[model samples]
Target: MSVLSDLKTVAVHRDFRKLFAVRLVSQCGDGMFQAGLATLFFFNPQNLATAAAVAGAFAILLLPFTLVAPFAGPLLDRWRRRQVLLGGNAIRVVLTLVLAVIMVTQGVSVAVYVLALVTLGVNRFLLAALSAGLPRVVPREQLLMANTLTPTLGAVSAVAGAGLGFLIGAISPAGVLKDGLTLTVAAVLFGCASALALRLGKDQLGPDRAATGRGRSWAEVAQDLRATAVDMADGARYLVRRRTPGMGLGVMAIHRFLYGVNFIALILISRNLLNDPADAGAGLATFGLLAGLSFAGNGLAIVLTPLAHERVRPSQWIVVCLLIGAVSQGLLAITPAFAMIVASAVLLGLSVQGAKIAVDTIVQRDTHDAFRGRAFSLYDMLYNAAFAGAAALAAAVLPDEGWSALVFAVLALVYVLLAVGYRAGIARIDDTPREVPVPQPLDEPTDLV
Candidate 1:
């Protein structure tokens, strides 16, 4: 059966379908905005300057999440999960709509852009809550499928959204009236998607609050903070204490750090550095193509990994892929040529996606439902921090010539070492390679909380 068929079989019986639908909508809007924003900045009078500023702004937004995400688990534990998810989306929807409006109004300012980026970071934190909520909606056996599918479909949506963005931006007249209509329509879609995600039912969200009397003092809030600190420490300890989880997280973090560079480097390559002014549009077009293709390669792994991992040790696969990534990053470092770089990007795509899948599957298999949310979210926060830092550094430090690509290569090489040292006993599943089990209809609700 196709990967879609597999995911559908899981979705049909559980709350996963509901959550997945919400993810799809949210991802679509985000993808559109990312593509549209980059293209818009490219055309703006202060193109390079604003573009670089936006990258730094996004990095700032991400830093707060890294510092604050550990606190969210307790909030999520105490509050209604569904409401938390919905409210987060609501904030994000407004932020995104504002962005669309600012562009159409020709009133774009770096301040407003930075504010929107921060708002999206908050929204993304709530997304972490939503991720935690998933295992509660499905059976243990299907968690991997559900987790993989969410990101896979999200990557696919990004590709489609980028296309939609490019076609609309490229093909449509920039007259205020026409641009207004499109922005208005996209805003409406963003709103609807937020509402859909907000519809997380009360039954699923109903975690019992601790009784108010004794624990309600001002000191208790401090105590609560302390308790969260302890939990976070334990969670960190849990991840690092184990050979597999620690190794897996390290490799994945490196993947994200380089991937962030890949994103920014593409823009610099296609839009700024190319020599053939006549081919500027083509170069940028290929940038989008290569980027979307990398993500497409990511989505493809939802199917391919079942076969690929069966053929080789997951650790060996990760190191080999990282080595390949280092080569491509090195190639990109030296060349100003567009086509050669785009070809190199394709190889980078394959390497990054494979490493990501290997790391995630290994960790998830070792984790239990109770701590997975906090554990995974913590890992995610670390990875996002690395990614955000890399993005900012790419913006601030990239040489007029060979900066980001070389940095990317060095980062990939570090992961190559981590992957090589990964304890094989930890990352491997001992079963004979066989057809993946089709999830029985999601007949039962899992208490991920």
Candidate 2:
């Protein structure tokens, strides 16, 4: 069914509608909050001029959460999801306000970073609650459609919020005031999201006592955490046995790593190479434009991926996408001209999204339902860690301006090698018939965030 039709079908569920509203509003605020941070970290004349500084910022924001994600599921299950949605956004509203005050008064500092970290961490719980609660609101028949519609629309809302934030920041004078004002707007939206969450009943989004049993004690929670590590290891072993999905995961990680490096490079190039180092506002605007173009390319991939599947196998499609990435990076290696960079952004965006779609399908198609959650948990960890690792690599190699033809050339070569290697690996695996494991019910409900 079409996306619009799916939305229309799910709109009849009042509870789903309420939950959807919360997700859309909260994610929009998320985008606005991120935009404010980007200005403060990347486009501000006084902050983050070097690649190392940018890398440090990414490490501070992303690495900690990547490490904590596995344990989050147990904690999330303890809370009433309705309260999680409400309290989480309410917490963010306060945190964002405090962050704005700090930006406006004291300027960027350790306090600001710590607050941002906490705010974003709360956001992770809110998102997990949304996904976990989804099954409770929608009928099993419509659940798939609801899943497809909600996240897609939420992403659109986020992009709209980001564009709005960028415009608001662009109009204001550069510095703390601009960032503070933008964050203030985000805080307001977060407040709205929190208010919306109140519309849902305390027990509406639930852990369902029958399903989860009694709440665990602190000791039991600790035990659960320990078991999570074992569960993850078991999932890894399963993937190794089912070579195709494991290889696919590896390829996706490589892609994410390379893409993350280019992302940091894009920021530096936009800030120092494309615009005057002192003209922070112009740099912000240029980056916004390029980012929008990149998102446009991502949107195009949504249309193209299914078409490609009809013509070639998903594995082959991955190779094509990787080659496309190589071509995109090669453009920058040839020249860092603004126009060439713009084109590269679009192509690279397409390549990343296209490859991701193919790999996601491969993982889902090959993984057993019993191990699916763990497989994706590992996927999420690799996704964030690869990007963080790439940021570190970029810091070590990229210059202050982020214009390194040598780095671009190396990235392009790596992309080509990854493509060739993945294709050959898939060819070898295709000849061997792999046994599919019988799915078993889990002892406890698994959170599939």
Candidate 3:
């Protein structure tokens, strides 16, 4: 089916509409919140001066969530997903308000970092709920379309939110008030997301009875740390048992690790190399413009991925994207010019989003519904942890100018290695089963059991 037809068919579902609304609003808020924080941490003259600071800020904001995923996945599998969405958004609303207040009063202090960590932790939960809930909303056949729409639109919403936040900061007075007000706007968006989430029924998005009993108590759902870790290990073992998902995840994790390095590079290049060091606003604007261009790539992915899946095998397509990443990174390393950086950003965005869609589909298709939550939670954990590890490495080596040809070369080599390694790993599957089985129409069993 064409994109328009798929969208028209899916959009008519009341529950999907509500869930999509929640995603859109929540992501927009996330965009604004991130922009506010980025400005405060990386673009402000008083705050951001070194690559080490940039890496520290990334760790401070993201690493805590990696710690939270074990507990989060188990809880998601036990609790009603709709309620999780509602409560997560509500918590985000409260946390964002608190963050705004902190931005106003204290700037980017330890208190702000702690609060941001909590807010991000909540966000990870909310996203996992949305992903888990998606299969329940639409028919199995349209899963590809649904995945394309929800995440791509949600990302566009986030980029729009970031742009709006940048606009607000640009117009407002400099310093604490600007970042504070931007975060406040994000809080309002999160509030709207919380309200929208209320429209869904309690059990609308589910952990089926097989996964969790109808009357699973909140206390039981609140599994202890040890139990959560054990569950996470179980999920890991499950992925290991399924060769395709495990291999696909490795491909994605490597891409994320390299992409994480690219992320810090872009920020530093914009803040120091691409723009005048003294003019932080100019630097922020440069980075924002590049981000917008990258989102353009995201838009192309949303439109192209489903269509591409029609002709290209997911595994092969992932290898193709990785090769693209290698080429992009290699070119950027050869000459870190502003124009080259912009082009690299677009290719990187396309490469990442393309690979991500393939991996997401693989996980959802191969993992049964009972284990989907845990599977995705592990995905999230690896995704962020890779980025955090990259940032830590970048902090140690990347200079203030962000022009490290050797680092870029290393990243390019890693992408090449992952692509080649992934291709070889999947050779046996291609020769035999050829492809993982996706869920068919209701006339056919999903094999979900």
The numbered model that scores best in lDDT is 3
By TM-score, who's the top model here? 3
Using TM-score as the measure, what is the rank order of every candidate, best first? Answer: 3, 2, 1
Q: Give all TM-scores, in the order shown.
A: 0.79, 0.82, 0.91
Per-residue lDDT of candidate 1, residues 286-338 (tens digit): 66767766665575566665556557755656676777677766676665566
In model 2, the runs with Cα more than 4 Å from the true position are: 1-23, 73-90, 124-154, 172-178, 191-218, 242-244, 364-372, 431-449
Q: Could you give me the TM-score of model 2 versus the true structure?
A: 0.82
Give me the runs in candidate 3 sitting further than 4 Å from their true place. 1-5, 174-176, 210-223, 431-449
Residue by residue across 204-240, what tens digits does model 2's lDDT show? Answer: 7755431243568999867767877766677778887
- Given candidate 1, what's the lDDT at residue 25? 73
Q: In each prediction, how many residue pairs overlap at the backbone (N, C-alpha, C within less than 3 A)?
A: 0, 0, 0
Candidate 3: minimum summed lDDT over ten consecutive residues — where?
440-449
* lDDT rank order: 3, 2, 1
- C-alpha local distance difference test of each model: 0.62, 0.78, 0.81
Model 3: per-residue lDDT, tens digit, 54-111? Answer: 9988888788787877677766776778777777888888888887887688766788
* Candidate 2 lDDT trough over 10 residues, lowest sum: 440-449
